[model samples]
Target: MEFFNSGLRKNITSVHPAYFIIGGFIGIHNVKYYYIFLSLIYILSVLGNTVVMTVIIVDHSLRTPKYIAVFNLAFVDLFGSSALVPKVLDTFLFDHRYISYNNCLSFLFFCFISLAMQSLNLVALSYDRLMAIIYPLHYHVKVTHRFMLFFISFLWLFVITVTLFAVGFLTRLSFCKSVVINSYFCDHGPLYRLACNDVTPNYAIFVFATGLILWTPLVFILASYCRMCYALLKISTSKERLKAFKTCTAHLSLVAIYYLPIIFVYCFGASIHPNTRILSLSLTHVIPPMLNPIIYVLQTQEIKESVKKMLKFRGRTKIATKN
Candidate 1:
């Protein structure tokens, strides 16, 4: 194990994988410039997700299982961005490319686990919306707080176990040649390419795992939305149907943003132009964290009102305390 760790470290530090080439024109300049952009995105994401989480936790009105799921999604995004962005920023700003082998493995594992959790949370949110739209009377009963807690817990455990297995599989391989990862963070696919040993089993396992994490939830979400649309169509009341449609539209938009780039990158292979890789990476990392908060504020009126009320209350409290 010590030898393996030392070898991994040496391999990773030996060469600077021309990641800028992956960015083409945009990445032409020093990587520090790119890190500046990534840092900005990271700061904004932290603020946005923190506010969302705060709103959900503090506002009693926003404690529904549906919103709880949103909170969890925000939490996942928070950590997911943290996992990749800091290292990326360090690399760009400090020219620090040497992530210890253990840290690299840990980073990779955490990222996948967080991503899987985010995907699972989306699945839960979709189901919650479906229940609300199709079976309003039983929605609350069916998706109790206990149920939400249990489901979220289950997702964490399951994804962690699966991610650990994947990481373990990765550790078994040797890296004889190129140690410099092509991308910013320790992405699984690029890392796999650097392995010296035959990786057929690793690739197969990755395919299965990726399908389970990405495709399965997506299929379920699509099915749920279709059923939801059908149910909405049956509702003759214009107001009721309109409300349902609005919710569905917002959720579908979020789903598209979250899933589409992921599918494109994972399914299509990363052999595209370097510019394409950078764009895909930006979409996968930057856009979703930025967009999710916007989607929630737009789709859920209660959140907007809560923000207004909270601000107003703070303003009044400040005046009263001053007097």
Candidate 2:
């Protein structure tokens, strides 16, 4: 009878420790306002990324190779934000943070995959810009649809393999103590803290994986952009040079926003305080998606013109329907 009663109590009291951990970070003091902020961030991110992606897709004139890369980035950001934001909002707002073991694993898996894809896509974008600026004559012929498709496929495959290895290492350990993850999301670093077993292997794998994915690509991007900058300086016409600079500015800004926080968070390791982690994760998830649409619309004059045309068309259609 005691054994049966204990089992019943266990079943009744069982809560995913992730709930408490995330709640602690988000609901640090005021639970109500924290959730409200989280909701606002989620809604804004979804709307902004969605609008950017839709505008790119619907505008036939915007279907260039360059815009295709932008489309891929937008798509990844949309889903990437979705992977964590919704669940996070739900957890904070409603106190419904009951994710099963399987669901938690799945969430972690998708988040890692989406993030890897985003990084890889940025690298591709950098390279595309590099080719356009350095070898304008051969840009079209060299970066064909087939080449883009192949490169994207390779990027996804490489990230997937890395994710599988990381996941394998993570899942091997048992979480017998506090299962709570002390971040806004199920990041490997925070999750590892809850494990009962030795995590040296996990740390080693994480370092190697992150270095390969983040550092190597970052080096390539910086090198390419440096070369592009040198080339831009040589152009004689101020107007053409300004236009070229403007073209690359949005991409560079987006890359900086997306990557700088990530590098800071991971490279700095556990030296950062828990509160710092919460703030960093929130900014990383919230700011980029909200700003990406603004960056694209402001940078690309063609997109601005299209937006004006769209608004005018809508106004005319509304008047015609009323008449």
Candidate lDDT (C-alpha), each: 0.77, 0.76
Cα RMSD to the true fold for all candidates:
4.8, 4.4
Q: Pick the candidate with the highest TM-score.
A: 1
What's model 2's TM-score? Answer: 0.87
Top-scoring candidate (lDDT): 1
Query: Which 10 consecutive positions of candidate 2 have the poorest summed lDDT?
Result: 12-21
**In candidate 1, residue 58 scores what lDDT?**
90
Candidate 2 residue pairs in backbone clash: 17-180
lDDT digits (tens) for residues 1-323 of candidate 2 = 23322333333323223222343354356757866776777787788778778787778988777777778778877887888778877766776655656677777888888778877888988988888888889999988777877787798899999998997677776665565556666778777766767889999999898888878889889999899989988898988877787778888988998888877877674787777777776777667776777788888787788788788989999999999
Off by over 4 Å in 2: 1-23, 237-239, 266-272
